[model samples]
Structures are given as C-alpha cells and as structure tokens.
Target: MIGTSEIILIFGIVIFWIPVILLIYLSIRYLINRSKKVHEEKTALDILKERYAKGEITKEEFEEIKKTLDSA
Candidate 1:
C-alpha cells in the first residue's frame, strides 16, 4: 500500500515534470512553426522573377519594376 509520503513525493515529481514537458513541447512546436514560416515566405524579387519567367510581364516592365524596387 502507498503511504502519504510516497503519494506526496509522486505528486511533486509529476508536478515538476508537467512544466518540463510543456516547455519542451512548446519549444519544439515554436521551432517547427518558425521553420515553416521561413520556408513559406517569399521575397518580392522572387515573385517578380517568377512572373517574368511566366511571360506575364514584358522585359521593359520587369526592368522598370525592378528599378523601382531597388530604389525603394
């Protein structure tokens, strides 16, 4: 049979680990989300290049926009 002291000790251990586990889980989740955000984010120049490659914009327009972006 479990005694009061053992029960208290078990409860204390569980209480201690709860926060430790939560911190680790949160850290991992934060890192994963941070990495996903980085991967999904795209620069304006990258989008411009994609559009130019698709022939959606003329070379002159591409150069004009690129110049505006560079100056800004």
Candidate 2:
C-alpha cells in the first residue's frame, strides 16, 4: 500500500517534469522556424544574384536591391 506522502511525492515528480518536456518541445520548434527563415533569405538572395547576372536588372537596380538585402 502507498502512503499519502509517497503519492504526493510521485505527483510532484510528474509535475516537475512537465515544464522540462515543454521547454524541449518549444526549443526544437524555435530552431526549426529559425532555420526556415534563414533558408528563405538565402534563397531570395540567390534569386536576386541570378537575376542581376542575367541582366534582368541594371547595375544601379542591382546595387540598390543588394543594399536592401544586406540591411535586412
């Protein structure tokens, strides 16, 4: 048979672990979101560079756009 004190101890342990589990889940989610944002920015920069190389943008336009991306 379990005493009341032992039952309380068990409950405390469970409660203590819940926040740890939530922190790990949130950390993973944050990393994934950060990685996705970085990938999006890299892709945008690559596209801009390609367009400039193809002469789709004039030198002044490319410089202005590149400056904007750099600032971001």
Candidate 3:
C-alpha cells in the first residue's frame, strides 16, 4: 500500500503538469483562431479591392467599404 507522502507526491506531479498542458492547448487554439481571422480579413479586402478596380464601386464607396472592413 502507498503511504500518505507517496500519494501527495503523485498529486503534486499531476498538479504541476496540468497547467502546462492547458497552456499548450490554449496557445494552439488561439493560433488557429487568429490565422482564420487573418485569412478572412485578407480575403474580404481582396474582394473589395477587386470590385473597386473593376469599376463596380466608386472610389468614395470603395474607401468607405475599406474603412468598414478594416474596423472589423
């Protein structure tokens, strides 16, 4: 049978590593989310610029739309 001190040692090891594991997981998730956001922003800006270049929107309208997208 394990003594009290042995159980405490095991618990301490687990407690110490739990936060490390959680931090790694959170960092990965944050990176993935940030990448998706950047890609979407780039795509939206590209579309807006394309429309402006094609003369679908006036220069003033393009500027306003660009400002809105950038604010997002």
Name the top TM-score candidate.
1
Model 1 C-alpha lDDT versus the unseen true structure: 0.97
The residue-by-residue lDDT of candidate 1 on 1-72, one tens digit each, is 999999999999999999999999999999999999999988899999999999999999999999999999
Ranking by lDDT: 1, 3, 2
Better of 2 and 3 by TM-score: 3
lDDT of 3: 0.94
Candidate 2 lDDT tens digits, 1-72: 999999999999999999999999999999999999987775667889899899999989988988998999
Candidate 3: tens digits of C-alpha lDDT, residues 1-72: 999999999999999999999999999999999999987765888899899999999999999999998999
Ranking by TM-score: 1, 3, 2
Clashing pairs in 1: none
Q: What is the C-alpha lDDT of each candidate?
A: 0.97, 0.92, 0.94
TM-score quality measure for candidate 2: 0.57
| Candidate 2, lDDT over the whole model | 0.92
Per-candidate TM-scores read 0.70, 0.57, 0.59
Candidate 3 ranges with C-alpha deviation above 4 Å: 42-72
